[model samples]
Target: MLELTTEQVAALAEIDAKRFVEGVRADLCKDDPKLVDDTTFSSRLWRAFKAAREVGIERDENLVAFLRVEAYAPSFYEQPAIRAWLTRPGRSADQRFHDYLRVVRWHIEHPKFQGGLNNGGSGSAGNRGGSASTWSGLGARWRGFIGRGSGGGSG
Candidate 1:
């Protein structure tokens, strides 16, 4: 579960689940250029889960189950790991939920995840005043991260 300040809890209570979901969806669609290219539903879910956690909503198995069943509906053909995970019956729901959040948090917290913008700048900072070659390096790196072209690959 995420530790929250009083302010965070108050902010969380102000937004109902529906509003939270819409906000997350809008942010992902508008801000994340790589949304369409993402291979798994986890990417989007991670953002929503993170948003909820940031606002002080306590993450639990029920929330995870709701995300999986309603928001994600992940396909085994596209995301086999989730399928394998859901099929496994041994782990408790709480354990699975925690593990899921841990993995998602690790991914999102990476500097390179969700394009270089997650790390710093507008991603255009390197373009403004930096050398052409330097900007290109950043562009190439971001392109690769977002799986843009032939040279681009999954992270």
Candidate 2:
């Protein structure tokens, strides 16, 4: 039998977290070259990682999804509706994440939910035009990612 001290455990956890962040950063940069040029990109990704951990979203795939949302809507967690969903009782973090995905999908699918989040009217950190199409693309990518079976983790 082997035993580890608390400090050792914490050190190991830190190392794991750093590796995970680096891996995610590489993947995201590969997905979007623009991030490689953004000076604040690493900081934002670290913040996203912390936010996901705060909300108990430890799974890698879920963390990636959360980061994707953060990339689109910097203030996503601050949105009243999103905050409510996150704090909803009787649900695990994974369940809440999945429900959030559903809401995003529904919003993307419906025409009425189009302009609000994209134009700075709703609780999103609005971007330029073509947000609807961008969100639709994100939804499609998410669908494809999620449909690929449940083998995701820190890799």
Candidate 3:
């Protein structure tokens, strides 16, 4: 059996994270050509990854969901309602992510939730012109990513 040192493990993890970030960057750019011209896009994506990790959403699928949401509504995770939901007890990371998706979807579908009526409407999906097709597209992409991952695991 091959045994790795702590430093080696850390280095490998870093490498994996870097690769993941780059892959996500490429996908984002492909999805939105404008991002390709934005030099700060990479940094923003990296920050989103860090933010997701900070919230215990480290799995690739969950991270993808977070990134998609962040792309649609910048600074979404910082909203009080979203922040509270993320910190709610008794749920695993996957469960929280799924529930968060439901909440976001619900908000998007309801017109009353649009225009900042709730949560100050700052960075809310409604504030970002979140149409049903747009959010449904995001949900479809998230489902695709989740489908490719192992059935269960937090990280």
Tell me the number of clashing residue pairs for each predicted model.
Answer: 0, 0, 1
- Model 1 scores a C-alpha lDDT of 0.44
C-alpha RMSD between model 1 and the true structure? 13.5
TM agreement with the true structure for every prediction? 0.29, 0.67, 0.66
**Number of the candidate with higher TM-score, 2 or 3:** 2
For residues 63-87, write the lDDT of model 2, one tens digit per residue: 8788776554454565565667776
Per-residue lDDT for 1-155 in model 1, tens only? Answer: 88999999878865575465555544443443444365554455655455434433354544543343223222211244543553457875445646654554444334344454455644342332323332233334433333443543442
Report the C-alpha displacement of residue 132, candidate 1, in angstroms. Answer: 32
Model 2: which residue pairs collide?
Answer: none
The candidate maximizing TM-score is: 2
In TM-score terms, candidate 3 sits at: 0.66
Poorest stretch of ten by lDDT in candidate 2:
141-150
lDDT of each: 0.44, 0.65, 0.65
Q: Which stretches in model 2 have alpha-carbon errors above 4 Å?
A: 112-155
Cand. 3 Cα-lDDT: 0.65
